[model samples]
Target: MTPTIPTRQPCPPGACICERERLVEIQGADLRILYLTRQEEKRLLDRLESLSSLSDLEHMQRRMFEQLGLRVTIVPSLNEVRSMRGIGINIDELPGLCRKTRQAIPAAIRRGLEKRPEIAYELLNANDLLRDA
Candidate 1:
């Protein structure tokens, strides 16, 4: 008996090569990870810290999903106890999350998130966010 080696199908025409590469890299992995450069992370953190309303967070979430295929949701903790589907992190927990990962989530932003837990979104890492099923 002969064992078969798995093969990846070729990407279709006009498909995003970068995205294809990312998918290939994560094949059979337990987690889908997105990596960001330090500058990118800083910019994202700055934007997150500046979000003034739920609408802003919603817009950012939509853009992230569209551009990076990352599903993120931000809502008031008082109205929703937990996310039924995707990963959920409390707004007040961003600092601790960052600490566990040894990422640079500024103290000012942590303070802000603590003060306004409603504006919280999951903070994964300085350069990447991981999603594991």
Candidate 2:
């Protein structure tokens, strides 16, 4: 007995491509690999691993996108991710992380703007004004 394969849903009107599993394709300009999560990643990996030539990889990437219902997301620079590995923090922690980093900077350097001295003075006055009120 043979297992039945699922049929793809028709592409939505006004959209160039059908949405599959909420998948969208993002391609990195230089990277040869398709970087996606879960089953899509698995399908692409299996296809890539079996390829014996560069042309085969290129053809397979295109074919996989069409047949497997996977989408791509392009990374502008993979270089940006190189230093960010294993820092197990979620998206919500980023702003607080940025604030902590700002706080860690040397106070003198952070304050060293000759053109912005008036702004600094204004901030200082505002602190005192708030304290008095």
Best by TM-score: 1
lDDT of 2 at 114: 25
Write model 1 residue lDDT over 29-131, tens digit each, in one string. Answer: 4222233334455676677667675466568667755644445543333333343212233333211122322233343344446555554444332113333
How accurate locally is residue 27 in candidate 1, as Cα lDDT from 0 to 100? 50
lDDT score, candidate 1: 0.42
Lowest lDDT block of 10, candidate 2: 87-96
> Cα miss at 79, model 1 (Å)?
8.5
User: Whole-model Cα lDDT per candidate?
Assistant: 0.42, 0.32
- List pairs with backbone clashes in candidate 2: 24-71, 24-72, 25-71, 25-72, 25-73, 26-72, 26-73, 26-74, 27-73, 27-74
- Which stretches of model 2 miss by more than 4 angstroms? 1-44, 72-133
What's the true lDDT of residue 66 in model 1? Answer: 65
What are the per-model numbers of colliding residue pairs? 1, 10
lDDT of 2 by residue, 15-64 (tens): 43223323323332211112332344445445544444434433654564
